[model samples]
Target: MRAPVAMKKVVISLFAILAGTSFALAADTGCDAFKWPVEREQALFPSAPAAQSGAALTVGEAVDFSLAAVDTISFEVPPGHAPAAGTFGATARVTVPPEGELQFSLSDDAWIDVVQDGKTVKSAAFSGVKNCPGIRKSLRFKLAGGAAIIQLSGAKKADLKVAVLTPE
Candidate 1:
């Protein structure tokens, strides 16, 4: 009887070990699966300018648009740090085609400023919209053909999508 009890204990311990190992392997495999998609995006949009960190913006074939991570952006907090803590930012160089309008949109939780020729054309802060549902703000500006800089800032790390549209 003592021998049988010892054998049973050993079997249970082996089963627990196997189960834990399997779970760990599955978790690692799942993380690896997500890496490929990010790698593919980086390969396809090789020409896009690199952000301070994270992935580079992907320029759409038909339209000039970029989806970028906010955490990678390097933001400069005001001297007084008026905004709440945890603010970050990034800038992107965009080309505005003739007769095209630059449409900048971001999650309601973020703040954005579009500047051209050292002039701030549009700026907004939506921090008060916490209770609002799906509250995304977009600003459209008539852009002349040439280079433009977009400055983005936010209190939280999130993704920002920017697009430039031309008349069909």
Candidate 2:
């Protein structure tokens, strides 16, 4: 009798765990798929300063710009992925603070690269939501303290917005 009761309790516990996990997954679909909070990035997308390509950018401030044709934009270093014709791209200079990890947020779909020392700094982590209103993607990269080039390529649209932030 004791053994049967213990087995029943284990089965009930497992069932409850699975049911809770399913509910959590169902709740986080679609626009809520991001693993971390992006409220700061979302709030900064609007009213951010408008900046042109090749201009200086700063952390904690968002900048909006119009992307030029991919073939016309000169990148400090070639983008990892070669963009096809009809795609838009741009480059901007930024001095990353000594902070550990920097988050790059974009308002649209695009390939982002942070080049330091003339080489591409690999992204540590990234997240994106398709059809999500306003913001589209966010990426984190560990960059050495100093000047770095921000390369944006393969954007489907000409109008683009970007922001570099220190993750809180």
Candidate 3:
């Protein structure tokens, strides 16, 4: 009976040590262990003709904006015109200058897709970063001077910073 009790104690001790070690390893690896709650606020979409509209952005300019979890912004095409989807996350239109080139970058924890003429031209996934805890990505494209749309989406509770740079 004494020998059996001693063996049981040893087994329990080993189990505890193993569990602790596993937890430490997971922490060190920066595992995505927590989920953030999504906000219930409605997304804002400015009118196409508004001064704040993406279509108002001129060539050789850069626009920076922040997006909340599950939020999206659409740019209207053909400078100063509204998108068919209304003022919602569906689409944003911007007139790319003739032979113009644009560069786009996003902070960690967000996804971006660019659509032109109903086709997806550029897409990138969000990656994890040690310092920022989000993804960093960039894409460049040449335009033929017409309407183009930029769509942005992000994870729950995660906010993202996006920058759009146009050629000078």
lDDT of each: 0.45, 0.87, 0.44
Task: Provide the TM-score for each candidate, comma-separated.
Answer: 0.44, 0.82, 0.42
Q: List, residue by residue over 82-135, the lDDT tens digit for candidate 2.
A: 888899999998888877478998899899999999899999999998866888
Question: Whose TM-score is greatest here?
Answer: 2
Error of 2 at 38 (Å): 0.9
What TM-score does prediction 3 earn? 0.42
Q: After superposition, how far is residue 165 of candidate 1 from its true place, in Å?
A: 3.3
lDDT of 1 by residue, 1-168 (tens): 266988999999999999999998776542233311222222323243324422323223211223345455553332122334555555666677765465443333455555567666543221122322322344456666677666666535444333333322
Q: lDDT at 76 for candidate 3?
A: 31
- Residue 112, candidate 2: how far off, in angstroms? 0.6
Pairs clashing within candidate 1:
none
Model 1 residue-pair collision total: 0
Q: Judging by lDDT against the true structure, name the best candidate.
A: 2
In candidate 2, how many clashes are counted?
0
Native-referenced Cα lDDT, model 2: 0.87
Alpha-carbon error at 163 in model 1, in Å?
Answer: 3.6
**Residue 125 CA displacement from its true place in model 1, Å:** 15
